[model samples]
Target: MKNVGVDGSTTLKVYESRGGYVAARKALAMDTNAVVEEVKKANLRGRGGAGFPAGVKWGFLPKDRTTTLLCVNADESEPPTFCNRVLMEHDPHQLIEGTIIAAYATRSQVAYIYMRGEFHEQFHVLQKAIDEAYEAGYLGKKVLGTDYALECYIHRGAGAYVCGEETGLIESLEGKRGQPRIKPPFPAIEGLFRRPTVVNNVETLSCLPHIMERGADWFTGIGPPHSAGPKLFCVSGPVNKPGCYEAAMDITVRELIERDDMGGGMLSGRKVKAVFPGGLSMGVLTVDELDMKMDFEDPRNYSLLGLGTAAAVVVDDATDIRLVLRNVARFYGTESCGQCTQCREGTSWMQRIAQRIESGAGRMEDLDLLLETARNMGMMPGLSICGLSDGATYPIETIVKKFRPELEAAIRSQPAGQVEAVLQAAN
Candidate 1:
């Protein structure tokens, strides 16, 4: 209840009443290195799906560095995930305070928040919060009478999911096509305008203020030892309460779905058929695995599904697996930036096959072809420019592997009624 984004509106008054800027005040009083040390002790990991440690990332920047940049990735284009908008809309100052602390720790003077173009309301709210902070002396030169000077800017992206990637974001910020740059000159070492930059997610940076205020031990005590701190799980589809719930990381999907405080089970008294634990990128889980723990490690341990974005999408018994695959394939095919041959051609191929199969034009051999294309497209370890290729392949691979019987059945059934059922269930 304390950290719920929907509880209080995201405004200067509401934020101040909830002790919003107190962390910024406390941070300004401490040595910058001490703040970095405290964050390191907290073992805070990136919430941007990569799970990189925030403090370690800060430490990677060169000492006595000037002109360093802190870029916040607010492009929450991952399909089933929408928690970042809540944070930006309901609690903008927390992000501001966290940004200032991170900038100070890295000795950066400028920060940019790269938000998704679709988030017009969130952008307006965050822009207003930034204006309020500058007027209130929380941002700009001589903040709270301290020598630290920080300036934050907001940049809206053009609805590209690839922009959620750090290098792609940097490229977009530079007014170029959002293609990912190669690593080894990692973003921490050489990033944004070729200067040492720290690109963090909106949720990742927002937690910094709380970590500083509550101390590392307090944060670590909230969740499981490995995945410390509270996580915001965005549940959608067929659930009685389809919204975001902020709880400890160790909470199980079964508990979340069944509890009145969370998802509260499937809607219309329908039984769950499948669940996508971490958005579509994490593949899918059949009904038997619904009890899997909603942690960073549990999915892999239980179902071999990687925890990609923490977006829980429930699919009830009335759902059709083939239609789900085709819809997801279409999304990836359309969203592919066409930067790489593997992604561009492979996504198109997968989409076509899924469509053909749905239209009853598919041969029994088409299923094998679909699996082959996905496998050869570098779904694992990623051969494309960004993670889009891998993300597309995940659902296809899982559907064919785990739900093969369903696909085969759809292929055998009469095209009119059965295919209609598949398409209808997709909606």
Candidate 2:
């Protein structure tokens, strides 16, 4: 991300002038296992929501697998997340070089960059870079004069948020409806036309070029031991400088929101009521808890889902918590693929409950109702096919749990009949 605007042009020539593709050349010279080992040693966790180790994911491929496919997830559908888009739009060749290296490491002859259909500008920029790579022989029949060959293509998605899921993206790329497939036969084992496929996020693949340049040890030394490397964070909502910034995980939630170089404090006298530490899906953090570190494991310590995309959305104190909950619930409800019974019903149920609460007719028991409904919908209960329901639940659950007093007060302020109905229901 730091290299985003370093060069004047997005073309391959300018990228090469800055020593781009050197990593690809270096990675191609190493044995496949050796390249994978270097990544493993770096402990490069995926910048995508899950925070899974990238090298470990690659190692999951079967040893005897003959035909492998690499899917680069450029579908940046997660709300408040645009770091991946910025990478592809400004420094496309960096992502291309990284993709070439990733294909080589996985021994894949074909790679598909599944981009969001809405990224019209980014599409042309990345495609231009691809054309440049082919012209320079960095990709295609023979990559950089090496025996290894790779064909990379940009396949735009129809803007379905579910396609951000690996199997859902595979389904969309396969010309089917973009719904998630059941696990156990994870993409690594049987994927994309039933061949072993490696599904990596755009930002995750973009890290490879850097790793290949600086050895794994150099990469690991930047951040914590378990999760090491520079991370691109997106800070949005009411902040002075609401944009993307790069740093190691050592930066805290407060620093991300208040640091001069980052969000630069809330916009002119607006106090933070709450902030979504790792995007809306990761659950809310109270202003008091802003000091918590924005790292993979630290978020769990603070009861968040995970580090997520590191895309923080700030909610000002003047905003109603009920409205925030309603907004988040509505998004997940509308986006649900309606496949799993739990997710289908759970999301709608929670959304309706949230809307009622926001509109001042909710029962006091609805708070618990929302939480109970969420509990049964996600992978945690082994009910849903993917994490969409899980994402829907976190914000609502956390909002209701952390801001109960405010919601209860709202319920109390209603008309006598409503208050009595709430008290009677509670009894």
> lDDT at 223 for candidate 1?
85
Instruction: Write model 2 residue lDDT over 295-330, tens digit each, in one string.
Output: 888888877889999999999988998899899999
Point to the candidate with the largest lDDT: 2
TM-score for predicted model 2 compared with the true structure? 0.96
Backbone clash total for model 2 is: 0
Task: Tell how far residue 126 is off in model 2, in angstroms.
Answer: 0.8
| Native-to-model Cα distance after best TM-score fit, residue 134 in candidate 1, in Å | 0.8
Superposition error at 388 for model 1 (Å): 2.0
TM-score of each: 0.93, 0.96
Kindly report which residue pairs in candidate 1 clash with one another: 10-90
